[model samples]
Target chain A: DVKVTQSSRYLVKRTGEKVFLECVQDMDHENMFWYRQDPGLGLRLIYFSYDVKMKEKGDIPEGYSVSREKKERFSLILESASTNQTSMYLCASSPSDSSYEQYFGPGTRLTVT
Target chain B: AQSVTQLDSQVPVFEEAPVELRCNYSSSVSVYLFWYVQYPNQGLQLLLKYLSGSTLVKGINGFEAEFNKSQTSFHLRKPSVHISDTAEYFCAVTEGNSGYSTLTFGKGTMLLVSP
Candidate 1:
């Protein structure tokens, strides 16, 4: 079975601290994505990586960055954690083609204080 | 650019009642539509998708959605809902025939099924 796993289920960080959220997929997919889910706002894409070392900014990429050193792992980074950044973060993976559905990780709930 | 809109924020219904969750989209070109369900505290799961050919698509858990190109809508419906079906549903769209699978999602609708 295809599976996606996030490094942490919950995290807490102080303002100005740097935070990392990791995601790994066993499906060997070429496309990976990071999104933040907020009440009323839904899930907004933060960043997506199409290949190793290749990344693109999404609609809401202002306060976030991503890294993909390997095909199966994608990481979302917060340079400076802030209260506004507190939300549930989701990671997903799909094959290179657009026809396949994205497989998602359980999610990481981050609390910024 | 493509965008999606989920008409209702929340819908409350009794168990075994029929339910409809509306979704609309705005895109200049052809698009692929999808419905995803997010259970409490978990990740999103694909409920169904409308890629091509058939206007009506059936999905897992006895749910289905119809694609209306002229109306620019893809509404999700189920004949009967169980209490276990309570969750948030999202509508998403991506430009069809594109090399990438990046999607634009709706704000989502919360389905509260009561016994």
Candidate 2:
């Protein structure tokens, strides 16, 4: 079974603070993605890495960046936390091939105050 | 570019009642369709996927979806829903190219099962 794990289940940060949310996958998949899920807006992608040290911006990448130092670990960085940035953060991974079914982590709910 | 639309935002039904969540999409190329379930605070889980062969696809948890190429729709259905089946359902699509496999998701539909 494929397993994706996030660093924290819940996190609270003050405004203007830098925050990092970590994600790790045990399946050795090649594609990793970060998304923020909101109530009505659904899930919007923040960033994704197809390979180590490579990153691509998604639909909503503003004020956020990602790091993929290793294949199994992908990290999401919030340069400066804001109240509007609070949402459920999800991490997912898929195989390098055409199989696009993403395996997701439990998710990290971030709160900015 | 590919886009998905889930028509209903919420669907409330009694236990043992049949239910359907509608999804439509527009894409330039042939597409792959998928339905995912998110329980409360959890992330998305694949319910089913339509790749090529079958128009009717069965998934986990007794859920199924039908792919209609001409209509550009993939609707999910379950015969009898339980309280445990309550969750948010999201429909997603991606270009079916062997090389490209990024997904575009729709605003999800919440299914509330009442006892």
Candidate 3:
């Protein structure tokens, strides 16, 4: 079974604080993605990495960046946390050559104050 | 650009009752359709996908969806739903024949199953 794990299930941060959200997938998938889920907005992609050290911006990449130093680990960094950025963050991984099915992490609910 | 629309924002149904969630897509090119389910406080899970071949595709948890090219719709259906089936369902679409899968999702439909 494919297992995706996140660093935190819930997080609280003050405005202007820097924040890091970590995600790791046990499966050696090449494609990794970061998405933010909001009420009535559904899931919107923030960033994705096709390989280590290779990243691409998604639809909503503003106020956020991603790092994939190693294959299994992908991190989302908030340059400066803001109240409008509060939402549930999800990470997903999929095999680049084989299947397009994405396996997702439990999620990290971030609250900015 | 591809876009998806889920007609119902919320569907309330009794346990063991049949349910259907309507979805429509707008894209000039061909597209792949998908339905994802998210339980309360949980991440989204792939319920089913329609790439090609069959119009009626079956997925996990006894859920299925039909792809209609004429109407540009892909509606999800389940014969009998359980309380555990209550969750948020998202309809998504991606450009077909693409090297990468970048899905565009709809707002979502909240399925509330009552016992």
Give the number of the best model, judged by lDDT: 1
**Span of 10 residues, lowest total lDDT, candidate 1 chain A:** A94-103
In the range A9-93, model 2's lDDT, one tens digit per residue, is 9999999999999999999898999999999888898899989999989999999999999999999999999999999999999
Give the worst 10-residue stretch by lDDT in candidate 1 chain B: B94-103
TM-score of chain A of 2: 0.98
Model 1: residue A41 alpha-carbon error in angstroms: 0.4
Q: How far off is model 1, as Cα RMSD?
A: 0.9
Docking class of 3: medium
Evaluate all candidate structures by whole-model CA lDDT and list the values in order. Answer: 0.94, 0.93, 0.93
- Fnat: each model in turn: 0.61, 0.53, 0.49
lDDT of 1 at A3: 98
TM-score of 3: 0.96
Tens digit per residue, CA lDDT, model 1, A1-108: 789999999999999999999999998899999999999999999999989999999989998999999999999999999999999999999997757588899999
Residue B35 deviation, candidate 1, in Å?
0.4
Lowest-lDDT window of 10 residues in candidate 3 chain B? B94-103
User: Chain B TM-score of all predictions, in order?
Assistant: 0.97, 0.96, 0.97
Runs of candidate 3 with Cα error greater than 4 angstroms are none
